[model samples]
Target: MRSLILVTASCSLLAACGNPAEEADDPIVAETPVAPTNAVDGMAGTYEVVMADGTVVSQTLRADGTYSDVAEGEVVETGSWRADGSRLCYDPEGDEPEQCFAGGQIAADGSFQTRDDQGNVVSTVRRIGDENMTTEPTA
Candidate 1:
């Protein structure tokens, strides 16, 4: 009886150890990492800015902190930009003071609006492309 019990236990252990399908079915998968959330990450791209006066201009926000505004195929303005939470601030190339705008939550259609202090819409910005500025390598 003891020999019979030992043989049954040994067969059970071997059967469990030899089953490759059970191990394959329950794989040890590594967890995928989550990306950090930042407002500037979404803002780095080309956009079409429509002012409240119905004037339209093309703006490009580079990932390297520089930006340019093009109007009528001419570079009208060049600036450096930064974001503080949801607020976006721009410092133009000249002696002009820094201009900061609030409300930068981009919409599903790649559109967002900048608002003034009194909750007025300053401009409507729509993303036109996904091309971001990249710096060239130095030798």
Candidate 2:
């Protein structure tokens, strides 16, 4: 009789084993987003930022991945830009932590939006017109 009770209890425990297929997909699996390559190239040009009061700041960016910001007849920011796989990096002339890569936007209209490493938009630069740059001897 004890063996019978033990067998009956084991059978009851097995019968209460709950349902399968509680989940459909693997919880451990996740998807990651891919970044674009030439987000900055679309912004390569001389942009003039017009403020609310109509103030302007001009910036010239080269295709070689170098940029210069001119304000008050002086260059404030000078840096080289490059792409690391899917990331765009902006490093100063040398080893400096001021490099911006976290959040940057190059609009289709040649406007630019710079952001910090945390992806916060810092500055907005708009394309005014073609630089029409020419080199000649200064008479």
Candidate 3:
């Protein structure tokens, strides 16, 4: 009788197991997003920033991933930069944290707005220099 009770309990436990077919039908899967390449080329130039307090600042973004942020003809910050889609991410040196700007709208007259990560317009940064390096003909 003891042997029969032990065998019955083992059979009950075995019956409680999940079905293999059900597990196979409901398999869990995860997917990751892919980032675009060569998205940073469009923003490689100098930008002029007129602050809310009426102070003008110059931010130069180079293609070699380095940037120089100048204020009042003095270099205030130097850092590295990258682009994710239309957004530009800056990683400044020292204790300053990284910030991202997006939603840029450039016009034919070489003017554009630089927006923050929340898609809000932080500053209207103008394109300072000639984007195309063309020399005038000398007579």
lDDT of 3: 0.47
Instruction: State residue 70's C-alpha deviation in candidate 1, in Å.
Output: 0.4
Candidate 1 at residue 133, lDDT?
Answer: 42
Clashing pairs in 1: none
In the order shown, the candidates' Cα RMSDs to the true structure are 25.0, 26.0, 25.9
Q: Where does the lowest 10-residue lDDT sum fall in candidate 2?
A: 1-10
* TM agreement with the true structure for every prediction: 0.64, 0.45, 0.59
Tell me how far the alpha carbon of residue 54 in candidate 1 is from the true structure, in angstroms, after superposition: 0.7
| Candidate 2 residue pairs that clash | none
- Estimate the TM-score for candidate 3: 0.59
Local distance difference test, each candidate = 0.52, 0.40, 0.47
lDDT of 1 by residue, 1-139 (tens): 1111111112211221223443455555223333336545545666667776766666667667777676667676777777654456677788877666664454545455666546666676665654454222223
After superposition, candidate 2 runs with Cα above 4 Å error = 1-42, 49-56, 83-88, 102-112, 131-139
Task: Give per-residue CA lDDT, model 2, range 71-98, as digits (tens).
Answer: 5565655675554433345555555643
Most TM-score-accurate candidate:
1
Assess the local accuracy of residue 39 in candidate 3 as a C-alpha lDDT between 0 and 100: 51
